[model samples]
Every structure is written in C-alpha cells, then in structure tokens.
Target chain A: NSKVIQTPRYLVKGQGQKAKMRCIPEKGHPVVFWYQQNKNNEFKFLINFQNQEVLQQIDMTEKRFSAECPSNSPCSLEIQSSEAGDSALYLCASSLPTGRQDTQYFGPGTRLLVL
Target chain B: AQSVTQPDARVTVSEGASLQLRCKYSYSGTPYLFWYVQYPRQGLQLLLKYYSGDPVVQGVNGFEAEFSKSNSSFHLRKASVHWSDSAVYFCALNSNAKLTFGKGTKLSVKS
Candidate 1:
C-alpha cells in the first residue's frame, strides 16, 4: 500500500514563468519518476532518480526541467521558463526498492497550465 | 526499439458486458508488459503486469491480460465490466526497464 503525495494539485504559470512540483514518495521507496501527460492522453517520461542519483532522463527534461531527490526530502521537479507547450499534467511516481516487479505508485499529479 | 500500441482510441461497453481492449507490442523478445488505468483527474494506476510464467495474468479490479508471443499482443479483458470501469487505459512496454507507454484508450461503460 504505497502512496505518493504531491503538492499543489493545480498550478498555473504564465509563459516564461517558473513552475515547481513536489512529490513525497512512499516510505522507504528509493525510485522516483516524473512524466508529462498532454491532452492527447500520451505520457512522456521526463526523468527518473534512483535514490539521489538520476538514472534516466529524456531530452525534454534536460532542456526545460530539472528534478532532484535530496536525502530524506521530498523530490522536486522544476520547470524553468515554462512555455505554452509546457502546459501539461506533470505526474510523479515512486517505486519500492525492487526494480522489475515493483509497481510504481503515482501521485495525484500537478496540472500545469501555461498561458 | 520497444513500443506499445492500443489501436482503439475509444471504446463503449454496456455494464456487465464482457470487454476486451487490444494492445500490441514491437520488441525483440518477451517484454515486460503492463496495463494501467487512470480515472478522471487521477494519475495512472497499475491494473496488471506480465513479465513471465503464465501467459494470462489477473490484475486488480477483475482485469486480466493475456500475452501471445506469436501475435505480439497483450490484450486486456474482463468477464463482466462495471459502470465504474469508465476510464483511460494505457498499455506499457518496458525495454531494458525503461517504460514506454501508448496513447491510452478511453473506455466508457454505459449503464
């Protein structure tokens, strides 16, 4: 019964404004992931961190987004200088120590609207 | 390269009716497949996953998926669908443990 909690369920940012989303992984989970879902119902993986080290990330994340999972603190995904295209639901997920069989638990997601 | 394809963009089924959502994949071998559901305004929830062993695996919410290696498909099915089954279903393929998701199929269960 893993539960991932996210802060500020809703977010609105103007073009070029910064947007930050936070996620508290389930207790003892060491893997965290960030994804962007658009109106088209397509999900794009942004980045993933194993403990405090990043394991994998997409090109889009490297350009506009930065995510970090500091020791014992909630993981944060920050979008710097958000553009109109950056407006989408950003979802955070966490998984237990197991990599293959562990089902990732997701947060409620932070809906970002960049106007 | 690994990918997941859910051909139907939308599906409507009556309550208590049997349901099947088609999902196909393109990978080198038996890949890690998963079915996830997303209710309105909620993040995705895992319904089931298939890694190995039995080709047919049961998941939460009475959902099950069958893996056919020859057909390269992992279709989701339910014996009797409930009205609360209305949601977007996504099929995912993990290549090298990196998740690749499909454009979800929106399922609407009618009363």
Candidate 2:
C-alpha cells in the first residue's frame, strides 16, 4: 500500500472562504508535488518542493495558494479565498531522489468543493 | 514546453481482450514517459515509467507501455485485461522536474 497520507478526504467551503488540507509524504522521500484535478479529469500542476524548498510552481499558485513543508510538520496547501472554480481533487505525491529518474508515489487525495 | 496528448477520451473493451491506449507528447529534449491510473475518487497510481533503456517497460497488473521516440508516442497495452482494470489512464511527460499530463483516457472493462 502507498504510505503517502492525506488528511480530510473531503472538504467543502463557501466562496471566499479559506480551505486547507495536509499531506505527509512517504518516509525518506524528499520531493513533494501538488496537483489539481478538475471535474473534467484534467490535471494541473500546482507546486513542488524539494526538502522544504520551493522548486517550481505555477502563477495561480502565487496569487491565492500558500503551501509549506516544514521540517517536522506535515505539508499543507491552503487556498486563501476559495472560488467555485477551485473545486477539484487535490493530489499529493512524493519521490525519492534516485540519481536517475525519481518515480513519484501518490496519496489518495483530498476532494474539495467550493460552493 | 512539454505537453502530452491522449487522443482517445474513452475506451471500452471486453474482459480478457487485448487493450491499447494511445498517447503522444511534445518536448524538445529527451522525455521521461509515465503511465498512471486513477480509480474513482482517488489519486493517480503509477502504472509504469520509462527513463531510458529498452523501449518497452512492464508495470503491475500485466500493464506495459512502449516508448517510440520517432513517433513521439507512448502507448499502454495489455494482453488480457480484467474487469477490475476499469479506470482513467493518464499519460505524462516529465521535464524540468515537473510532469505534464494528458487529459486521460477513461477505460471501461466489460464482463
């Protein structure tokens, strides 16, 4: 079974409300990635971290999304003000640095509904 | 920029029948290919990945994918699929430490 864990399998928020979810990556994995899956099943890359350092992120992430992976705490992604368009499945994945390509393992994900 | 395209939006196949899902990608440099399967209300599970070596790579549950640099295609295949294989399959390209995913192909297996 995958070890990556995500809290609150489902979340609901009204427009302009703040929404947050957490993730604990698999043991020993240093790379964490966040992705958004819309109802159409289209995936959008949100952000990624390499051992608590931001590696790459999209523009929308800078505006309303805030994420952090502290040393001893679970990584969290928070939307400052939720919009109806923000309703989607948020997936978290972790990968170990392998010298070669790092294969990412994913958690079950958190489904968010913005009303 | 790297992008992936899964031409077929949905595919249906009978149990015990062969299966194939086509994927095409666009990238300037060498590409890393991966196949991921997402069950209902769940995150994606990695089916297989291709970094280097042989063009064909095998994954769990009898799943396999072939990488064709010439055609810029990476297609998933299974000799005989089980009904439990019903799910959405995504084809992704890894570049610059990020993954660009295709829209995904929804597979429905019939008994």
Candidate 3:
C-alpha cells in the first residue's frame, strides 16, 4: 500500500474545462512534488513545495498550472483550462527535507485525458 | 545539469535467467543514484538507491544495484528472473534536490 494517495485515478475532461487532482502526502513529510509523465515515458518535474511554500518550479507551472499544499489539508494541482496536450499522468511524491537522504515516495497518480 | 541514460530501451529475457539493466549518468558533482520500477498502472516503487557508501547495495525482491563512480554507472542485477519482474525500470539522479529520471527501459520476461 502506498502512503502517498492521489484521488480520482482517472479523469476525463473537455478542452477548456478546468481539471484538478488532489494528493495526500505521507505523514511527517514536509516536502511535496508534482511531476507529469507523458505517453513517451518522459518525466517532467512540474513543481515542489515545502510546507506550503514553493521551493522550485518550472516555467510551465507559472502559466496555466497551479498547485498548493496547505497545512492540514490535501495538496492539489489545478489546471485552469484543460488542453489535449495536457493529457498525461500527474504524479505526486513526498519526501523529507533532509539534504542527502531525500528519497521520495510516489503515489499511483491521476491519469488525465482531455478531449 | 544531471542526466540519466538508460542505454537499452527494451530488454528481453527468459524466466529463471540472470538479468541486468544498464544505466549511465552524467553529473559534475557527487552523484546520488536510484532505481525505480513501475508496474502496469501502478505507482513507481523504489528498488534501490546509491549514496556515498558501499558500491553494492541490496534491494527488495532479490534486486541489487552496483554503483561505479569511475564509469558513472549504476547497474541493476538479479540472480534469477521471474515473469512478475517484467516491468518498466527507471534510473534517476538527484540534482539540486530533485530527481532527473531516464527515458526508462521496458523489461520483457518470457516464460
């Protein structure tokens, strides 16, 4: 069983519709990361947060993608307007902030399909 | 930038046969390597990781990986393979607190 949990294992949305996914990180973990895996098996690091504060993120996240990890709440990633190109597996991972031993644990992921 | 390369995109082997998956990485600083396996429609599971310690590290399900700093390689090995072991294997490198994964290699185990 995975400690990291992502809701809505599969999602289908129309183009221009909003899509969102939620994740619950492992207990005592302060760092949360979001990655996008495309059909070609390319893993793209989207964003990461440390206790509700954004640590690192890519340029793509700044435009249409938004994410938040609030205290005592499940973290979420939202896309303002869904696009066909946005169809992919959205993975959530959590890890300790410890410098050298930051082994991340991943969730099953939410597979999104935009029509 | 740190990058991981899985030379072989696909590998085929028979059950009970010894298996090896090659991984090469490029990084200017000290390297931290990890191997993760992804079953069909499942989340990635950590097979093993390599830090600053022993060159050979043991993992779950009879999986083991050897870290070679000289060659910039971290290869995964298993003594005997099972059909259940067939899955996509990814090699990753930690760079600036984030993991950079390879294109992944698909393993096919024939009965």
Best by lDDT: 3
**Over 4 Å off in model 1, which ranges?**
none
TM-score values for chain B across all models: 0.97, 0.98, 0.98
Interface RMSD per candidate (angstroms) = 1.9, 1.9, 1.4
lDDT of 3 at B21: 98
Per-prediction DockQ comes to 0.61, 0.62, 0.68
In candidate 2, which residue pairs clash? none
| Fnat scores for every prediction | 0.55, 0.55, 0.53
**Per-model TM-score on C-alpha atoms:** 0.95, 0.97, 0.97
Candidate 3 has a TM-score of 0.97
User: How far out, in Å, is residue B7 in model 2?
Assistant: 0.4
Model 3: runs farther than 4 Å from truth? none
The Cα error of candidate 2 at residue A113, in Å, is 0.1
lDDT of 2 by residue, B34-103 (tens): 9999998888899999998999999999999999999999999999999999999999888877788999
Q: Give the CAPRI rating of model 1.
A: medium
Error of 1 at A29 (Å): 1.1
Model 2 C-alpha lDDT per residue in residues A60-100, reported as the tens digit of each score:
73489999999999999999999999999999999986533
The order by descending TM-score is 3, 2, 1
Clashes of each: 0, 0, 0
Q: Candidate 3: give the clashing pairs.
A: none
Name the lDDT of candidate 2: 0.92
